[model samples]
Target chain A: MHALATLIALSLASPAAPLDWHPDLSSAEAAAEESGRAMLIVFR
Target chain B: MVRPTTLLSLVASRFECVRVTDMAGVDLDRHRFDFDLTSCILLQRADGHRYHTFGGRTWEGAESHLSVPALVRVLVRTLEEHEKAELPPRGRSGPGRTVEALPPLARRIEAGRRPACIHCHSVHDWQVEAAKEAKRWRPQDGWVFPDPREFGFSVDPIEQERVVSVEARVEGLQVGDRILAIEGTPVLTFGDIVLALDRSGDGPSVRMRLLPVSGGPSASPVERVVSTSRGWREPDPLLYSWRAMKWNLDPSPGFGGPQLTARELGGLGLAPGTFAFRVQYLVDGGARAETGRSAARAGLRVGDVVLSLDGRSDFRSVDHVHAWFRLTRRAGETVILEVLREGERRRIDLPVVGLGR
Candidate 1:
């Protein structure tokens, strides 16, 4: 019970990683092929 | 370097986000957009219909051109446009000219195998280097792009589809007029106009359209011509950095270092206000070792303090001196540099050569 509470507390404290960024264009396109989502590329 | 704001994070979650660090990942065939950018956010359909693009800055500040509201608007607009799913006509994305390995610097990078990757902003410098290598470097080439603001207008990135800021006392543009095209080419977004203006060569005449700001039925366009003047474009430091880097490494006269302090100046028998660069590198990088050794051969050793170039002590910094050399003098020009070498003052006439000579 205590461990469950600790996990819940930690989850609340930690920010969720927002986006799953694909390493490269090919991987992103593959994911897009599966999900029907558009590719959003941010070039730095 | 990219810290996601809360707003960006929210929008990012809804899309298939791909982060590219270098230029090679970009599609030269489909993603034809501005290559001279430091940061570009591109959203497109999976089958290569580009929805929108944002980025193009003055290149001097840490601030991005994007605001949260602006990005939100772009994202909303992108989603709306994505619903259409209509493939844009071929070659309409601009960059119609032949795209090849450009600028001598890019070739130099590929040959040296240093830095491993090319960033888009560096293309500006590479172009200038290529021009120098070809012995066609000139002052007119220094201003590589003309900002649209030179025509008494600034764009609102948020309302890219609708808004334009007309400068005070501008005669032609009206508050109700929305920019529809440039040089007779239809531009859908601000990014399109940016690419058109960037690609437009020296002193080119451009035709533009002004449509009614209000959408739909009651709209007819009025046309205007912009004769780009020779004095219109302003010289930017981003392009000038190429000369700075080349000279910092090249032999004969190219080198990089810092300005000498007043006390250091006085010790060298120079004035308190003397502008001398205390040489930090003759050729420090493996990529530049071949070219940097020329300065050493020309008696500009690593410790040498250079006082003046072309017999003038008015240079601002090492970069300034290099920019002055490139802007004022052409390739193959002779420049007399005065340096304090090994506690002895001497004059050396450096016969400037372009890259890879």
Candidate 2:
């Protein structure tokens, strides 16, 4: 539990990792996040 | 029409029977002779009308006439003068004196300066030979014309396609993910995952193994797994390496890179001014066989904001990130990650696994 808590704390404090992932967002969400246009992420 | 007097003056200026004239009102017809002869002349009427003619048989009428034989003699003389013109004037031989140092008259006539005919009654063959020589020596490549709109940049966004690979967090997936129970089935290297998803039948889910990110004893064990319908999305066109290797200034041919804006970042659930991160999570079953290694297994999840890599502060593009991984890390190596999760920054240690193949 301490390790988990420490890990969570460290992640929040630094919030920078080489291996972090982002959830695939909806087109609407992507549009809201970016300007001009949204990125198309298709899984095949 | 060329005045007889003007034509005679032209003939006196040099030794040529036919002289080219300026036409005022109409086009003149012309023809060639069997002995490889060509001609051009301008004709004008008393009424201010004029005609220009070219490429015809030698003039035969009383109008400026020179027999072929007499024309050759004058041509020779003109060629001699041309040869004299080529040398420095001080070194030229006296008039009528043949100089061995100078080029032959025939060669000069072939060089293209002497006129074909005289303006007056004199028939000058020198000019005609010169013109023929000039016509024969055209450059090989031909003339190059310039394009009017040579510097325009136009883009057609509809034709864009890019190949990209996504490394995601999969807790239940491990190495040796089978295709219909075939062990050692290569997935990542061949890019079969995308193909499988693209050609999958009307099924609710697909199964695959995920390797552990860390090679520690606590890593998770590989297990058979199924992704629920809510967990899957239609695969986009595959981003091939050949296409994704470079970015086109014009978006017409391939997919354009993400142009992130402040607003867009916020909409993707990222904080304004915060850098975005893409993470990969590995799930491994083999590690479970070894005690304590199973706990080290981890996978990247959505919504994680990455801040740095190997202590580097800058956040590069996704492609740069992949290159960094391929260059610096090896399979089974542990990586320290700092991410923003649940509105808080957290640090996690994950192990690297062999890229799915």
Candidate 3:
């Protein structure tokens, strides 16, 4: 029950405007370097 | 995971984000983390130099230390750190080393025994196999990613990086203190702290720098060194039993069942909290058949009630006994079991043997 509620909460909490998530680390690193931005790599 | 706040969305938008669900192509050396976690985040530069790691939990629960607000705070802090253009501490980056190339895993793959899909926990499984294959497996090798509470401090879950309380003996620290670094490596999340402790491994002491809440985040940090004792990383025996890697350890008890209820214990003239459990079945025919056979040959039988192991009766449950055995006992030792069979007491000497040795 707790797990279900957390899943629901996470679904509701997800931002509506989808952030552009690179498919892999190399691509993300290339994009970060090109755009001068940091990389937030999430392992789920 | 950042909640749908405008500030969070704005902060998250500035970075290049990636969600990795599999470890297939991940460079193990460059992207090291606590595989025990279901979710982890790494804030790093384009060059793959890590600024700090985020995510981890104690045995409390999987999301016990996770907070969206805290993640937002970390994101903002990481952006600021990025703007400073300072490189991460030395040794933060590594030569690429993929998980599939891990020696044991490579061997298994070559033998056509590769898992269909490699999940986070599979990483730990491979690591244990590697250690065992090298003939250097120890009980303590199972202890990974030790929590901060093991060192006499509790990090505030919501704040994520601040100390909420300190045990009396942990000198030079106080409640509301913010941890800046562990062993000179900057730490902004629970994952970072655990990684530091994991790297420290059985060391006598750890040194950390703290920023007191009274002086706020800009305070001149104070240094504190705390010594660790033997078995300092050991969690509650019951909690330790939940580890996936426990199955890779040796000396299984060969038999177990539910802990006796209070009423059952009362009927049997036993104390409520003492160790007492009935034997439901012996592992007579399986991968652990030898263990069950050894216990049975020593006079252990189904329907017998185990009272204590080696005269120790403080265990919380039958599983606790099994965990304690694997964690503390070696292969060649003999364990004396006090059991009750048909209202008569008996002592059985069960020889401990290594599994898959």
TM-score for each predicted model, relative to the true structure:
0.62, 0.21, 0.79
Cα lDDT, all candidates: 0.59, 0.29, 0.76
Ranking by TM-score: 3, 1, 2
lDDT of 1 at B81: 63
Ranking by DockQ: 3, 1, 2
Query: For each candidate, what's the DockQ?
Result: 0.28, 0.01, 0.48
> How many clashes would you count in candidate 1?
7
Which tens-of-lDDT digit does each residue in B1-357 have in candidate 3?
534455555677788888777888788867888886677878888766778887876555677667667777888899998999854332224447777877888988999998777887788888777777788777767777777777777887767668887877566667888888888778888888888878875665788887877787578888877665555666545556545566666778788888888898898888766668999988888668888888899999998999888898888656568778887777889999999988899999989876855
TM-score of 1: 0.62
Flag clash pairs in model 1. Answer: B247-B254, B247-B255, B248-B255, B251-B294, B251-B295, B252-B294, B252-B295
Q: Best-fitting candidate, measured by DockQ?
A: 3
Ranking of candidates on lDDT, top first: 3, 1, 2
Candidate 1 or 3, higher lDDT? Answer: 3
Runs off by more than 4 Å, candidate 2: A1-44, B1-261, B264-274, B278-296, B355-357
TM-score of chain B of 1: 0.61
Residue-wise C-alpha lDDT for candidate 1, range B199-251, written one tens digit per residue: 66655356778776653567888787655444445443333433323332232
